[model samples]
Target: MYKLVKPLLFSMDPEAAHHTVSGGLRSFCKLWGGKRLLRTAYGCEHPALRREVFGLTFRNPVGLAAGFDKNAEYVEEMAALGFGFIEIGTVTPRPQPGNERPRLFRLVDDRALINRMGFNNQGVDVAATRLRQLKNRENLVIGGNIGKNKLTPNEEAVSDYIQCFDALFDVVDYFVVNVSSPNTPGLRALQEKEPLTHILNTLQQRNRKGGVSRPILLKIAPDLTHDQLDDIIEIVRETGIAGVIATNTTIGREGLRSGERLTAEAGGVSGMPLAARATEVIRYLATQSGHAFPIIGVGGIHTPEDAAEKIAAGATLVQLYTGFIYEGPGLIKRICKKLVAG
Candidate 1:
């Protein structure tokens, strides 16, 4: 069914297709028995696939990475597809229209995607409202991937993150401080040791003052050097954050068969080209840190082997974005089946 539909979706502009598919799924999930039917077809339940990480028990380890559903509009719809977890947002304290048209590109030949989506979302408040309305989220572990507004300067960025974290703390099961996206100007600067440590420390201080302290994780970029990654490991330990989401999309475009025409696009690249380096980054962090922290490996997992490879590399859990787009919803069930078989 998806194979027949993929051509039409692929024919449309990438971002437009994204909205169309997401909207359609949301509608479908509202229909009578829609979720049960989807579960029967795509859900794989097995005790071996269940995982306990960061104090939350996941039905499985596969999660839908952030940026697929930037807002919290489709949590129920995505959950119906059988992912153990779903991460929403790169959301900010305020809403903003993202980068200009033609920002999302499909490099079909490479089975990859490039986007300069600039964390476009309806702000954390809107998402919190939507999350509060959901009645069936108990089974799905949700992570709020929080980021600063594009207009916010580096100096005051901590305030933006704090506001988002505060707004979403009650709703999401966990939080991800996203400072690695390449689309936002000066956003990656927040990933540096000083700013990163400050943001985490401040968030930790706030978490300690509260009711049920939710897990906070750091999401890092794949483009970092070994020294930078080492710094991140130390930062994780120092701040007492839950863990890290290893390897966000890369700015690097070397050896892409997608050619200069598509490769020349200015944004982060995700998919097959990212798998090796993403795995390398995961391996480096896990080994060097002596597995000191939990790492959710996410980059270019399009197959069961890829998921297995990430786990072997020491990822406590794994996530998919580009792979879900390329392989369809069945990918999660397939990956879980393989994991169970092993």
Candidate 2:
């Protein structure tokens, strides 16, 4: 079905196609029997695929990564499609329309996408309100990936992160500090040792004060050097972070089969071009940490073999975004089925 519809979606603008699919799914899930029908067709559940990580139980290790539903609007829709978890946002304290138009582009030949979406989301409060209404769905685990607004400078970034952490404390299952998005100017600077430590430590302190603390994870870019990854590993240990999401997207457009003109478009590159490098980062962190913390592997996963490579490299869980767009809903079931078969 998705293969048949691919041409039409491909014909539309990338961002427009994204909105159409999201809106269509939102409407589809609203139908009386829509969720049931979706699950029957695309959902795959098996005991063999169950994973217990970060003191929480996951029905499967396959998750829909952040940036897909930036405002927590499609948890139910995505859950029905068989993802064990869904992460939303890169949300900020205030709502800001991200970078200019034409920020999202597709590199058709490379099966890749270049996006500068810039954490555009309806502020933390709105997402909190939306999430509060989802209390009834106990099986779905939601992760809030938080970031600072564009105008917010790096020195005061911790406050922005804390605001989001405090606002979403009651709703999300885990927290992902998103200081890695290239589209947000100086955002990646927060990933530096001193500032990153301050943010994570501050959040940890607040988490401890709460009645039930939620796990916190750091989402990093694949463009970092080995020395930088070493710093990240140390910071995770120092701050008691739950784990890391090994990679956002890459700034490097190395070896893509796509046209140079399109590849030259400024943004982080995701999809097949990102697979090996992302896995390398995951393997580095896992091996360097001696498997100390859990890692969510994401980047260029279009097939079960791609996912398996990440697992073999050390990812406890895996996520999909570009592959989901290209391969459709069945990718979730396909990956989960492969995990079960193993």
Candidate 3:
């Protein structure tokens, strides 16, 4: 079905295609027996596929990465497609319209996407409400990927993260502190040791309050140096955060086969172009940290083998975004089957 539909979607603008597909799925799943039908076609279950990570039981280790469902609008819709988890938002405390149009682009030749969408979202409160209203959350593990507003200065970024964390703490299963997106001006600066420690420590302090705390993970850029990753290990240990999401997206365009025009587009590149580097980061973090914490590996996973690669490289879980767009929902089931077969 996706093979038949792919060409038509490819003809539309990348972002428009995303909206169309999201809307179509939401509407389709509303019909009688709709969710059951989708489950029949796409869902996979096996004891071997189940995983216990960060004290959470995942039906499988495959997850829908953030950015795809930035506002928590499609949690149930995506859950029906056989993901073990769904992450929503790079949400901010206040609503902001992100970067300009043509912010999301598809590089068909290289099976990649360059997006400068910034952190455009409807704010954390809206996402929290939508998540709170989820009626069929059985076995659903949702993560809130939180970030600062673009307009917020670096000095005040901790407050924005705190606000988002508090608003979403009750609703999300886990929290991903996002200081890694390259699109937001000066946002990556927070990844530095001094400021990054401040933000995580602040969140960790709040997370311990009220006798309940969620697993907090740091999402880091693939562009980080070995020194930076070492610092990341130190930070995770120091802050007592749960783990790390090895990569966000990379600004480097080292080996893209796409034309110069598309490659020159200013944003982070994700998809096949990021596969090796992402896995490398995961392995580094795992080995360097002596496998002390879980890692959610995501980037350039367009096949079951790619998913397996992340796991083999020490990713406790794996996620899909560009690969989900390019390979369709069947990719999720295929990955689960492969894991079970092993």
lDDT of each: 0.93, 0.94, 0.95
Candidate 1, 1-342: lDDT as tens digits: 788899999999988999999989878878999988988888999999999998999999999999988889989888888999999998999999989878999999999999998888998999999999998884899999999999999999999999999999889999999999999999999999999999999999999884679999999999999999989999998999999998799999987887788999999999999999999999999999999989999989999999999999999999999999998999999999999999
Candidate 3 residues 164-276, lDDT tens each? 99999999999999999999999999999999999999999999999999999999999999999999999999999999997899999998888999999999999999999
Clashing pairs in 2: none
The pairs that clash in candidate 1 are none
Query: Number of clashing residue pairs in every model?
Result: 0, 0, 0
Model 2 ranges with Cα > 4 A deviation: none
Cα RMSD for candidates in order? 0.8, 0.8, 0.6
lDDT of 2 by residue, 1-342 (tens): 999999999999999999999999989988999989999999998999889999988989999999999998888899999999999898999999998989999998999999998888889999999999984564888999999999998998999999999999999999999999999998888889999999999999999994789999999999999999999999999999999998899999889988888989999999999999999999999999999999999999999999999999999999999999999999999899888888
TM-score of each: 0.99, 0.99, 0.99
